[model samples]
Target: MIEPPRFFSAADASIAVSHLFVRPDMLITLGFYKRKPGLSREQFSQHWREVRGPLIASNPILSKYLTRYVQHHCVPSNGWPNVGDLEYDGFSESWFDSLEARKEMHALPYFQSEMIADEHRFLDMKATRILMFDNQVVQVGRDYSAEIAAGKA
Candidate 1:
């Protein structure tokens, strides 16, 4: 079996994470979630798009740490059939300036209580998964970041 070449300390891993990725300007987190048992997809979607989105917007502490936030609703696709474990109801992508900033946001009282309960209303926390990474911009057909930020998009 293949094995690690050498032991890695947290500092070593942190340095690699910052420099190894193509995009280091921001750290992006993808939170994949499954609906709570007995909750319908429509109900989950409505609550996520309506209640959760607005809740985050209203919370200033969350906004302080989040540079960008987006939600992705899972849709049926013919290319790949949904299979067990691989199926997720939806996912959220949020960008933070640093790992410490994200951690601070999570530790806030408002996020720990109100946010946690709100998520529990429609999500099975046990089935939720989180992944963090930096992206590589391979190609862009359209550029809209500036326009969108300026409220012109």
Candidate 2:
């Protein structure tokens, strides 16, 4: 049996809101991936949270184009009924205005060199996958479908 209470750790608090001003132009990108071979989850998450995330944010290329950037540090989703192993170790979520702006960042030498080099340290690029899309938020809160059905909106 899984003992979640014994091992569970929580993330720090965060706040988020969606504004219509950014809705039309903002593009959201998700990079799903696994850690490099031989690295522990602690090692991966520390380097990513402490080193890699800061590195990306500090760069002029990314900083200018990116409005928000977030890293997801995966924890074992044990204790959920019928759950299987997680497919990837963690993922990155980034928000920017346009693909053209993103492409401009990608074209920079700093991105091609420094950023890619840093990612090599802890990410398994071969196993990485990307998803790019815009949000069409029906809701962004705890599920309240039952309440909504009863006209709580």
- Best candidate per TM-score, number? 2
Top candidate (lDDT): 1
Q: How would you encode candidate 2's per-residue C-alpha lDDT over 1-153 as one tens digit per residue?
A: 111121112232122443223355567677887999999999989999988988887776678988888898888878787888668889888887776767787888888988889889999999987776554344455655455556664
Number of backbone-clashing residue pairs for each candidate, in the order shown: 0, 0
Model 2 CA deviation exceeding 4 Å by range: 1-21, 140-153
RMSD of 1: 8.6
* Residue 65, candidate 1: C-alpha displacement in angstroms: 0.5
Pairs clashing in candidate 2? Answer: none
Per-residue lDDT tens digits for candidate 1, residues 114-136, read 88999899999999877765543
